[model samples]
Target: MKCKDCQFCKYEGAGIAGGYKCKHPNIEESAKKYEQLKRKVINKDYPHIGYQMIKTSLRYCPYRIDREESL
Candidate 1:
């Protein structure tokens, strides 16, 4: 799939791979806020931050040509 189709994609340089990288937040990092929130979750034993974050990150990519244009 093209960067435009992926939520984690960002338009930085030019061309495909040259200009793109996976920018999904969770892929990039677990921020202080997220870590704190994860600690507070009742089900601390379970892995709860992987899939959802990936999905969300992919869904909101900046370089996605198919992505909805902002007004």
Candidate 2:
């Protein structure tokens, strides 16, 4: 099966654990990259701000927060 076009799979497995893509090359690469990113953050003991920092600091990112409309 093909990966999800939502493309969020790119961020899975830092314990990201969201949508899954059924055994596709793209998903495999994404999981690998995510794990590598997770390790990098751990090695550095976390940073100040941004994706890299937050990635290492927290298990998951806060960017997953949903936007609320004020209408």
Candidate 2's TM-score reads 0.24
**What is the lDDT for 9 in model 2?**
31
Query: Each candidate's lDDT (Cα)?
Result: 0.37, 0.29
- Candidate 2, residue 45: Cα displacement in angstroms equals 28
Clashing pairs in 1: 4-64, 4-65, 7-58, 7-61
- Residue 58 error, candidate 1, Å: 11
Model 2 regions more than 4 Å off: 1-23, 40-71
